[model samples]
Target: MPTLTKPKEHNRERPVVFMENVSKIYPNGKTAVQNVSLEIEEGEFISFVGPSGCGKSTIFNMISGIIEHSVGKLEILGTTPTLARQQSTDVSFVFQEPTLLPWRSVLDNVMLPLEFRNVTKQEKLEKAHHVLKMVGLSEYTKALPRELSGGMKMRVSIARALVSKPKLLLMDEPFGALDEITRQNLQSELLRIWETEKMTVLFITHNVFEAVYLSTKIAVMTPSPGKVESVVEVPLPFPRNEDFRTSHQFSDIAAKVSQDLKF
Candidate 1:
């Protein structure tokens, strides 16, 4: 059995997520990632972009402790990834799809994470309601997932992730399935939530424009048996909008990321 060996107290000197020449190799002798190093600060919104099978999802799984690396150091929130993923610690994940329970009402699905928590029923309800409102889903709390549109369903998923008030949020292409209009709308909504919550976000996206728009920093990776090609900085100020997206700086940054992305 592999047990977690983490620092007794949170190590404030380190970044929120620190990866030192990490690599992931599967039992089948597949090297999904190699020599990937990154340091995410306390409140940054980072987007990772690469082609399919480029190990973007692999990196995410490692950070969330769903899988372990074959070599090198990776820490989340000042501790080992596995330990940081425990309850009472601040980490949450939103998948590429809205994996909600179709049978449950929106509010019930959002409140499920709190079921095992030590909080009282009232506390859970308050937290659920607060997050639902934050995602603009308060009015549809009683509706089932089947009754919601794609965008609304995703909103509920985000609200559910936020219910726990995670300090680090990992989203794997959460808006990838939506139409362009809805995707852009949710992008703005996400920025609003991030600005207020101040959570460190790690996002995965295939779209370069979306990556540049949402990220304070963007990491580009190479194809299969992935390795980070480069880290591109988005120096633009936050509260990004249509104007920022249209600006030359935005295009310049997006082009830089695009150039770094290898086929």
Candidate 2:
């Protein structure tokens, strides 16, 4: 049996993401999220899971400054979300689809972000190549998106996200589109990247098992008019493998997260 490790206490000096009584109401008078609050510390991997229409993606967009919250306070790295986005390379987002440009090579795709910056062409090339290597896609730098498999394309997406060296990475069901085998493989790969990069990750997914497998904490949300019902801790040690996934502790935590989603 794999030993279950207890989660260590975090020093709550300044959270990477802080939300209090945050709510999002669209112009049509529909409430997407209601009074959702969460505090995520540095280097923690947090996953949000809930039923469909639970406002999981809504919360993500709000945090990323794609949209504004209708009420309450929201801050990223002690600054307003908009300011955090404009003044610093503190955040990045990965969506459900890989969203790669079919015409562009892997290297060019990853270099897109840096091209908009003040860096020289050589500097952009170096940064893009570095991140491609980090994501294990260095050898595929010249391949177009159509030439890669689903998993490989997602790797390119991840590399693009990391090219900016952001402090926070937000993913919206990034692996939901892959097959089981590929999904499991990428889940492990993502963990490896997270550990190596040491960035705060906020991942939204519908898979309770994936959430338990990858996250330090799982935030379960209620149905439409989404509110965080509970945040369950996964007190498992790092470098978790297939053995840990099949362990009793893994099943217990997954079941608990499922129960929370049901309520």
* Candidate that scores best on lDDT: 2
Q: Against the correct fold, how does model 1 do in TM-score?
A: 0.94
Q: How much lDDT does each candidate structure score?
A: 0.89, 0.90
Q: Which stretches of model 1 miss by more than 4 angstroms?
A: 1-12
Summarize candidate 1's per-residue lDDT along 1-263 as a digit string, tens digits.
11111344765466888888899999999999998888788888989999999999999999999999889999998888898887454999999999999999999999999997888999999999999999998899899999999999999999999999999999999999999999999999999999999999999999999999998888888997888887788888978889988999998998888888755
Candidate 2 local distance difference test against the native: 0.90
TM-score of each model, paired residue for residue: 0.94, 0.95
Residue 64, model 2, lDDT? 91
Q: Candidate 1: which pairs clash?
A: none
RMSD of each: 4.8, 4.0
Which window of ten consecutive residues has the lowest lDDT sum in model 1? 1-10
